[model samples]
Target: MTAASIVDPMFISGASVWPLVEGGKGVAASNGTSAGAWAAAGGVGTISGVNADLIDDNGEYVPLIYKGRDRKARHEELVEYSTKGAISQARIAHELRQGEGRIHLNVLWEMGGCERVLTGVLEGAKGLIHGVTCGAGMPYRLAEICARHEVHYYPIISSARAFRALWKRTYHKFGDWLGAVVYEDPWRAGGHNGLSNAESPDQPENPFPRVLELRKMMREMGLDQIPIVMAGGVWHLKEWMNWIGNKELGPIAFQFGTRPLLTQESPIPQAWKERLLGVAPGEVALHQFSPTGFYSSAVRNSFLNELYERSERQVAYSDDPSDADGRTVFLPYGRSNHGVYLTPADHARATAWMVEGFTQPMRTPDGTLIFVAPDRARQIRRDQADCMGCLSHCRFSAWKDRDNYATGHQPDPRSFCIQKTLQDIAHGRGDPIDNQLMFSGHNAYRFGQDPFYKGGFIPTVKQLVQRILTGE
Candidate 1:
């Protein structure tokens, strides 16, 4: 390794490029324009293959509109739409890179019709996408798909055990196509996190030990030269000097998720970019509100506050009016007056919330009731009704993509429709930066503190890459 290892280029995905990687953000955040510019800057650029956008004749993004009449039909339409968009984005990225750097596609394993979309994109955009990085589920078929397409596969995992399990179960058969293992620190990363049941979201563990463990396990598996991309909470390369030349870990790389959001090539709206500049410490939160049932990090705003408040205003319930404790009170259910019983103390709390205008009590799959304002309840119902089946199984709408097209449970009022909000925010519909779901890394406050972004100045992708290479 060179003394100036931070600026040294490392080979990745059949190309010699900087170890810096752009982690893909979905719903039009990191698109072809941004990914291509990063690739042009001589780094691995990842395009969000999840719900990519298409351009119209005027060189503007075409609004995603569904023509299907029902959830299942709409899901099929979504799959077809995503394939075309992915192909278009891949071509654009390939053109912009000019064959200088590799362009990787990022897709979620649990996204609706993952297999069909991957098949269509890889077949439709042959030789354009060099690799595919997948997370959010086991994705046992990812290696097989990438192998068939003649592309590399990178699996994003939180721990060494997860990677070991994946390799033993299926990836071992396609080891030749294994690109690298992305060790994304679940507590600090933006978007959907990979935190397991044993990990506490409040107590973030040191990523150094985790990455070291992963590298140790990889070496034992005869994968010493395979690069490990350290993601999440990584701000400056200078702060990570020890990891570069350490003998314990070989061929290390870095991935940036939130730092690139302020670049000119980023596809997110101007309002969203501006919002990042003013973010303060503790403004971003790691919460579990996604319909996919994964812990995600997002900026704290009215949108997130509403969800937090709903969970706070919740109480357990029972069907029997007379409980064994003999201190039960009943709350009517949508004119049925069904004996939904609650303890006396809980009843008092619910009555107080009702008097405060939280009259609507919605039942969740967990057998708990969340009290929300009537307007909010109606909006939730409306959003649930407009489900497009973007996820394989959504708790918000209880719409499953396969089988009977339902999760065999009622729509969860505790969750919100992620598809609608992500699309709306990306389209800048009504400038919903604060009103819609906004994902960000926990280190977002660095944008406000870093002198590099002083005076609300936004840099181009190339300039940002150069700045990062300087270890700042």
Candidate 2:
């Protein structure tokens, strides 16, 4: 490949650095150490703001423990903890960068207390953070928040339609501070995806056309010079040679989320990193199981398998017999006069599941019930009861940040507590391999075949950056 095929150092939102960037991962996956080293390597580093970790005065990590008795109190503690953690990470990253490169903070708009957490971090870390990259919802207020902080803002979108809606609604007024627009391929990206009802995960489309659409929209709106950061499904610079300096997609940059996870400076546990080396093709599954009600891509480990099976072990039901199928039978569980109406076929299936030790049947908000073991059922209930308002609207617990803090629906047994699992996995507090939510992109399997990582060599952040610059 020609030298021009590789990305050259350029100015991005006022910071001069290599166009390469480390995409943010949540629950402490991408932190001060990783982001700092990446920036020192002359690439843009993104520190995750989703429940980040805090460091003590002696440079020791501080474990977050909630002492509140109720959800409301715990939620308040969560906001406070998140804000402090973000600020601490920013400081560490800034210090490590030593006035080189740039650091950006990433947050999910659907995250609980997002506004409060963003305000606290930006205010607490003032000039340390250069930009804010946000996704997972239509973040209309993101521009306003970044404007107030005098930092650039990048809105991660999956479609041109989504960007158009944002620009028309809010981003238009704050165009001066628009740093860049990120186009994360929903079906291929790791972590939580942004696939809407119009797009199906099974029907993956070419990112070129989709990104061209985004560029066209940006050009029409007078944002042509602003770079469009292409995220998700990106592996190496050589594979994307045509996209480099393509005039049709002016000022394009590539963001790497999965490739950097195996570097020496990556903060993930050793076991998690080893797991990445052995992943096979098609092992990562894109499914709708997040409490935020968004599609996410993760490894099909036992944790994901259990959730998939839980949804499979479900049957539709109705409060009134006449409202459902012709066969009406009282659900032999719950209080008297609270029997649900179910079909004869579904009743038989439910009975068989009960005989298999899945005796506890829990109702979902969508007129269905799933059977689980008694202990599992108890754990689900406790998890739901101990909700810390992690999301603005939680599908698992039926919790909302506003409207009296309730969604007015029965808790869903099909979904699990994301806060508990993500925290558990990130901290390595439990089994890392079998029963944890491991987020990854579909192309993660390439780790095994990539020649740069032959003999399972894990390079340092600097080495990795140098290797990437070779157009490998």
lDDT per residue as tens, model 1, 137-230: 8889999999999999999999999999999999999999999999999999999999999999999999999999999999888899989999
lDDT for 179 in candidate 2 is 91
Cα-based lDDT for every prediction = 0.90, 0.90
- Lowest summed lDDT across 10 adjacent residues in model 1 is found at 1-10
Residue 322, candidate 2: alpha-carbon lDDT: 59
Q: Candidate 2: list runs displaced more than 4 Å.
A: 1-5, 335-338
Off by over 4 Å in 1: 1-5, 56-58, 325-327
Evaluate residue 66 in candidate 2 and report its C-alpha lDDT on the 0 to 100 scale.
Answer: 87
Clash count in backbone of candidate 1: 0
